[model samples]
Target: MIRSGNPALKESTFLDLGTGAVVSRNAGAMTLNGTVNRTGILLLLCVLTATYTWNTALTPTGELAPGALLYILGGAIGGFILAMVTIFKKTWAPVTAPLYALAEGLFLGAISAMYEVKFNGIVLQAVLLTFGTLFALLMAYRSGWIKATENFKLGVVAATGGIALIYLATIVLGFFNINIPYIHESGLIGIAFSLFVVVVAALNLVLDFDFIETGVEQNAPKYMEWYAAFGLMVTLVWLYIEFLRLLSKLQSRN
Candidate 1:
């Protein structure tokens, strides 16, 4: 059984979809190539929408335009809702997943532009590092250098859960005007914490890879290609955001 640290791509995601379901022979079973193709499509949609928000967030003077926050909030909240919908209604992924991507792109582009405005060239650095980590880990996983052992999956899942709890606590405490001390600061401990989160996020990609491969092997429904791609996109988005935060922290110190 394949297990992913990503909540969307759980171990049971592909189970039993192959056995007694109504599958169309002409539609074909899920394949790695199909998933890759759908992933590319979703990414293209994301990038296109992202460019819209990215441009909208800036003025000719290169200053942040007013009302950018509207776009950001809209994207964030809309994406969250669509993501929940897609998570529960996997069959609607062909429609909702792309919508989710577009919504998330708006959020990412706005946030990235804000980071770039403060720290010149930080967005490019974060983007390069994000994709670099992705390809490197993909190569490692393919080359058998990194195996998704049971223990590894368990550790990553646990670490991911802990990180989630930490972020949750931090958010909750924020209402009380309390902060998590150095965890969000630019101190050494904060940098270390960000670095650790980035590593765990990267490892989650390996689990995603394993899960997608398992889905293919299990003959999961063809629409699962889109769902699987959506799950991968979720991880990539999280990784990119973490990279942005880490790079910003590092740049602040310099």
Candidate 2:
């Protein structure tokens, strides 16, 4: 018998969607493996982004030209599409991974061009620093020096989410010709916030590592490589941006 208005009813009996009990369990397990492959796919995306950004920033005309805006716009649109595909298409990893990489490359290229012009050699410095931080974090994770407990992971996620919200709000405020004064000129507070964001980004790598280990142990499906790579790419990209911004803020203070 079924009961009405019951939120805790046996979901299997009502919404099983015809998948047998055994298959459902198997599918649930595969999800663990999928996470591993996603990290690998993300690394490939990082390579693509780096290549594009390097070429754009190192060009003869470089950041001085107006043509770079087109690339930025294209990258933005492509990134949105990539996010949609990743979230909605379970089977789209293989196809969408490369596309996301290309789009991210275009976007990074234009942004890097501007930074390169402003800071003069800041691009390479940020790149080297970003990779160094990544390597150090990887070593720490492998050695079990910084275990990401549930609370740690939750805290990072919350902080990252808050940082994202602030960025979005800043973007929206820009349309009204208003800016967050502190983020640009509040001296110690701005530096402190940037430091916090960098820490949060580093912490995300721990979660990524945990996800990869879980996937490998669970023997995730083959397509999961793309998914894992995608996940890593997302984290690395965020980390790199934070690093670059931190450097810029520090340099400005000096």
Candidate 3:
């Protein structure tokens, strides 16, 4: 009954795919250290790919390099596909997770570079804020300062779902030549909305931490280390994007 607001780390994430069985202790079970180490590996892979894409997407002249959009689109689609595959086939996470990280890196790298062109120093600011929030929340959660109570989870899940619906509506409306006002603007309303979203996104990391500890306690299979890492990466990516959006909104106000 492990629950998380992150869609990737849903309830029953560590349960056997079809057997409805719990992992045995001798089955090379998931460990906190192992998951943490694998998370580092995935982060390294993501950073490597992101750096490459950033270099390739932005030329020395500060203009976009050719095929930049391809990197973005390819990464977006490819990362989505790989993530779905990994979710449905958890055993394949040892392979698909790394691929997913690389693809997402490409997508994020290109997007961040473009943002840098419009708002110099924004990318670094976003990265710092993202990781800073991560550490701060982790410390808070580990020290019992923040607990993922049922009410907290429900609130975060509801907020996340609302945000998803808003994004979906925005996309659907775009098809009809309609644009949502204020939400995407740099005005006070937009900034407030972005700040709220950022807080929710950061709160998700708390759920992620609680969820992963539950997985380890359940003795999820060793391969689940990769799956767990993937789930955490998904949250981290979302958080980083929200920070970017929030920072961009604030910068635009200047």
Candidate 4:
């Protein structure tokens, strides 16, 4: 059984796809290469939309361009709704995944611009660190240096759940103007918190790798390639955001 920390990817995501049923003449089983190609397409879509919002966030005076907040809020909410839809209807991933990527790009671009404006070169640093960590972990997982053992998966999942609960509580408490102490501060504790979150986010990718491989081994439907890719993208987005926050916290200290 495959278990991942990503909410978008459950243990049964690829298992209940009528594995024993006859496949249509036009449909092919999921493959690693196919998922990789679809992931590339989704990433391209994200970069295209991100460029638009990144440019839009810039202005003549280097201040936030008009309607930047609109893009951020629209992207965040729209992406979230689309993600939920795709999670429930896996078949719709071919269409919804790209849309989710685009929406996320808008949100990421605006947020990155805001960070960049305050701390020069921070966005670039965050981007490089994000992808660097991704490739490093991919290599580690591929080389068998970082196996997704059952215990490891369980630990990561538990930690991820705890992190989610903390974030949820923080959001709820915001209504009362209550902050979670040093967790959001720029001090050592805040940086440490962000670093821990980033590590957990990175570890989630190993589970994602295991899940996608399981999907291929199970001979899931071709559309599942897109679904699996979507799941991976979800983790990557979360990792990138945490990297941004961590970098910002560090920059604030200097």
- Each model's TM-score, in the order given? 0.96, 0.80, 0.97, 0.96
| Residues 10-72 of candidate 2: C-alpha lDDT, one tens digit per residue | 112122224422133355434544554455555566567756765754557644466677777
Clashing pairs in 1: none
Prediction 1 global C-alpha lDDT: 0.90
Tens-digit lDDT track of model 3 for 14-53:
8877686768889789999999999999999999999999
Better of 1 and 2 by lDDT: 1
* Candidate 3 CA-lDDT value: 0.91
Q: After superposition, how far is residue 133 of candidate 1 from its true place, in Å?
A: 0.9
Segments of candidate 4 deviating more than 4 angstroms: 16-27
Residue 29, model 4, lDDT:
83
Local distance difference test, per candidate? 0.90, 0.66, 0.91, 0.90
Q: How do the residues 38-109 of candidate 1 rate in per-residue lDDT, one tens digit apiece?
A: 999999989998899999998888878787888889999999999899888887888999999999999988
Q: What tens digits encode model 4's per-residue C-alpha lDDT throughout 1-254?
A: 56799998887787444564524425688899999999999899999998899899978677788788888899999999999999998889999999999999999888878888888898898889988998999999999999999999999999999999999999999999999999999999999999999999999999999988877877778888899999999999999999999998998998
Q: What value does the lDDT take at residue 164 in candidate 3? A: 91
